[model samples]
Target: MEITAKVPETSLKIKQKAIVIGGSIAGLLIARVLTDYFDQVTIVERDRFPDEPQPRSGVPQSHQLHVLLTQGYRTLNQLFPGLEEELASWDVYTLNWTADLKWLLPGGWSPHFPSELKTQSCSRNLLEFLIRKRLAAYSNLEFKETTIVTGLLLNPNRTAVEGVKLRHSNGTETQLTAQFIVDASGRNSQTPQWLKSLGYEPPQETIVNAFLGYSTRWYEYAGNEPLDYKALYLMPRAPHQSRGGVLYRVEGNRWIIGLIGVGKDYPPTDEVGFLEFARSLRNSEVYEAIKNAQPISPIYGYRRTENRLRHYEGLSRFPNNFVVVGDAVCVFNPVYGQGMTVAGLAALLLDQCFKQHTKSNSNPDLKNLGKQFQKKLALANKVPWLMATGEDLRWFTTEGEQPSVMTRFLQWYIEQVIFLASDQAEVYQAFMEVIHMTKPSTVFFRPSILLSVMRRMLSRHHKS
Candidate 1:
């Protein structure tokens, strides 16, 4: 990893440093954004980053099936140009989501057609690896592997974060002072406790757990000929079937099969149980794809699928120069595949806020910067959070507050959208655009789309 030119410290008049905890995707993207403002950006991680595209200890779900939505894909391209081509060099496959994926929605099978909703298909390890590799081109960015961030160092008034105290794997402890600190440490972040210890109240939390769990296995699948699509999604129908599965094409001519069960009925990791769970899915496509494929790894099971949101934006008091992003603030149900995309949007928002803050002040005074950004991030999270929670609430076993009347109406309309998408290419494209986060949810309410939905509904009703 080499950079064309080094940004010398002498050229930086501000002499500010930004420290980001965790070297995962969120942290890496934050570091990338900070390089434009801060003179130095250091990333602290508890686990050493592997040199190759392989899973590390810190990211437990790296081995699972991960999809980069359209919005995230575009963001990565904007942040690191030519990344898609580079990923292709690594054998990463690119496919149009609607055209290439065979999705079995609750209404019916989604119609296959070409659309602008293209995505990259590969393991999370490869995606992280490419992002980290791209970061090496920035002279101001640094990574401190095997270093755990213990807590934050605050100002004399305890109202602003100065830096972070960290402990290395060798048992050595030190404090690095930074003008800004960001916590992107995933779902197990200790920010809440750290804030409470600093005499500040923790943000209100909302948890909506569906008791969703999944088991995944990788295989060297040489599929039988006549394979038309690159991916298969067997979605679970609520109130009737609680089992679902997906088969995705990954690098190295491999396929990753994931079996999902909701309502505390988790898929098992044992060989027989794994196959049995696949066979029990809503459809036979997942089982058929992996029935004869040679599995290359043991089944990995994960169960932390709850949708959690911390209302940090609503807090009356919060320290300046410190902000939380990614799963630390909001963790979505993985079944929706919205986590990475939301994190990407947050990073982009961080960049935007910095620009706004600088334009308003001459010396980049960050007064209320953390609070303002958190509020905006919360707004950015509105759609995805509602979408995930609304879908999760469909199951009677899901534990959460009842949906509002408006929410129920929207859900019903979305169901109609899904049913129309089964055969109508226009409706399918609009729906996919929204789900991919490239367009607003209001697209479903467009006059043309609503008319299509109404016609489809009336036709079905008359036939019945």
Candidate 2:
């Protein structure tokens, strides 16, 4: 393996151990961050990574389509400089969010225009492959693959995490000691249960399920036809129509077609049913794009689409030196395409907390580290959680807490804004910015956007 950068061992020396569970994107990133503060960072992964970009047992959704939002794209570059260029070398496509993509909103088709929100388009497998490869550069990092983390090891008083109990594939169990344990496990994480086993109360969970399900197929683009855009999204309308689909360019001149259904409407995995479901989408773009395309892979189905927030920050009593990140903390509805980006942000937050702790004291007290990081992570997750859950609530069949008056009002306002965005380029740009996480939600409340929304709402009301 090629060494990325040789760090002077004496420059950043600390006699500490940090263990990160799960070697997915989030875990790898956490390991990267820990290297600066810890003497050794071990990432325990359930599956050995593939030599190249391919699916693995741990990440079931590795075959699915994924895009890095503008913020995530930028953050990744900051973490691993020239990452975008490296992906390009591997044939990952970077498409303009608005100009090179077509969107079919409930109101109408979104107007095409140039915007700063450029999206990094590629398969989840390819992205993970690149991240893992980059992680190989750190001399202080180590990965113990094909190992399962059974539980956490706590101190004598059970006040702080001491390490983790690991079970090897050969059925042998052992303990690895660490000053800090970071859980980057995905949606099926067992952190809550592990915490409860140690006599600590588990974080309360908030689930909003739209019963969303999807079927995806990989296709090789037949160079015979000319394409109008690099990607396309046909959104599902709530209450009445619940079918949506997206077809986008990935690596190797191939495209991924995923058809989504909400409220228990599931896309079929069989070929005949899959094509029929794609054809039945509100817009014909996705179906048309894939109808004559060559399918390189079989249809795969995924159904765990609930937006689950494990409210770790709300827990009054929590163990020190143990913190959760990534989907282990919050799993959003995947159709919103926020998982990777949110994970990236959480890793950034963890890095900040570590830097702040190191700067303030020569020997920082690590007992309260977990609680402080959890609270900060919760604040970081607030906006994305609201955006995802609010949209999920639009469907009446969604299960979870009832929408508050404030939520309902904001939802109404956002729906109007979406309508205005469909026609106006400026409004669409602002909307894209908010969704891309580069701008705050308050951008939608700007005077220009608000006036247009009111004008459109009143005009429609008068017409009706």
Candidate 3:
């Protein structure tokens, strides 16, 4: 989608207003896009945002290691120009994923070469703070913090959402009306219950859980170590080696190390067990790098890693003038680092849908906009959802629908691609591109890659 496209003059003349629930990265991005098309945009957040780049009570995963994939970084730069420079001023490290990362795959170490897949390494707190700062500069935007959205306010026919009923921190209740409303609330969204209360059938849900968990700790970086790579990733081989870890260098001269475990082998919050978990990874690079690092923060544990998709698009009837985005509609396992990037893509999609609506209709109407957007958004989220769930299903402990034949074949093909990536720079770059969402999975289907994969498979088959 052309995110920088100019909003039609007709759109600006309309007295339209938009309200976004939750002040998350997705909500902030949606509000930024709505500012261009709507006369007013208000963000309703349950928690008061922090003045500085610090974790707030609303986002529990703020202290963990967060990665902005290549596409996500580019999308942010597009939305907020000079974002990279601003992050650089804050000491956020921008590194090429291929060259600056030491990634140990299931087979072995992946090949490292200079590539265009560069990403920002920073804490979630800092990224959200910077995005919110940028959004504050817009005159058409406003933030309603320390307020809870109690329920949806529907019109007389109850076919469209006219507004939201909000309860302030002081227990005062009020209704805020808007032409359009979006729910960007994270995994704990209550939109389903609200819809059911209004006599609407809730969307069907699909959940794939691997029972994965991770514990993270921050270490002060003195810049005296002889590390060649800027980041380290040790992936756990499924079904056997179920432990992994990552050491990411973020802003403020600090390293956020996350020790991960799958299949209900949750990482412990205590320091001793955290280190022991890291020490048990398939590779010791993460452990060795942080073994003697100066610790700066307590070990924080998180266990709600699951791939969930609320099939909002499949709903036969949805409220008009209302839509859902981000974790409210679908949430993926964070281990693949697809959440922020997918959210960015969804924001861009929202912008595109609005632009198209304005062009197609003489008097742009949002009567069925929610349904249209949800349908397109479901198509957009398919690849990432499949990618995350496919990987999780490799473990026997994962609970979800059984993998189909095509899914199993794709799994085997991807394993071959990863095995080839261990020794082939070209294959590694292609895999990284797909993983970063810069290229489609068809990249692996090219003649050269196909030949290499087939030859390797055939050779191993003959030997067996």
Candidate 3 yields a Cα-based lDDT of 0.89
Tens digits of per-residue lDDT for model 1, 6-63: 4544334445899999999889888888887888899999998999999888999997
Question: Per-residue lDDT for 37-123 in model 3, tens only?
Answer: 888889999999999999988889888888889999999999888788888888777798999998998778878788889877888
**Which regions of candidate 2 are displaced past 4 Å?**
1-3, 6-13
Stretches off by above 4 angstroms in model 3 are: 1-13, 360-362
RMSD of 1: 2.0
Error of 2 at 101 (Å): 0.9
Query: For candidate 3, what is the TM-score?
Result: 0.97
Clashing pairs in 2: none
* Rank order (by TM-score, best first): 2, 3, 1
- The C-alpha RMSD of each candidate to the native structure, in angstroms, is 2.0, 1.4, 2.7
Q: Is candidate 1 or candidate 3 better by lDDT?
A: 3
Angstrom error at residue 441, model 1: 0.3
Kindly list the per-residue Cα lDDT of model 2 for residues 1-464, writing each as its tens digit: 34384544543445688999999988877777788778788999989889999999899988777777888887788777768878888776779998988899888998998878885788888888888888788888888999999999989988999999999999999999998899998888998999899888999999999999989999998878788889899999988799999988998999999899999999999999999999999978888888888999999999988999999999999999989999999999999888888888888888788777777565666788789999999998988988898999999899998779999899888888888888899899988898889999999999999999889988989999
The window of 10 residues in a row where model 2 has the poorest summed lDDT is 5-14
Per-prediction TM-score, please? 0.96, 0.97, 0.97
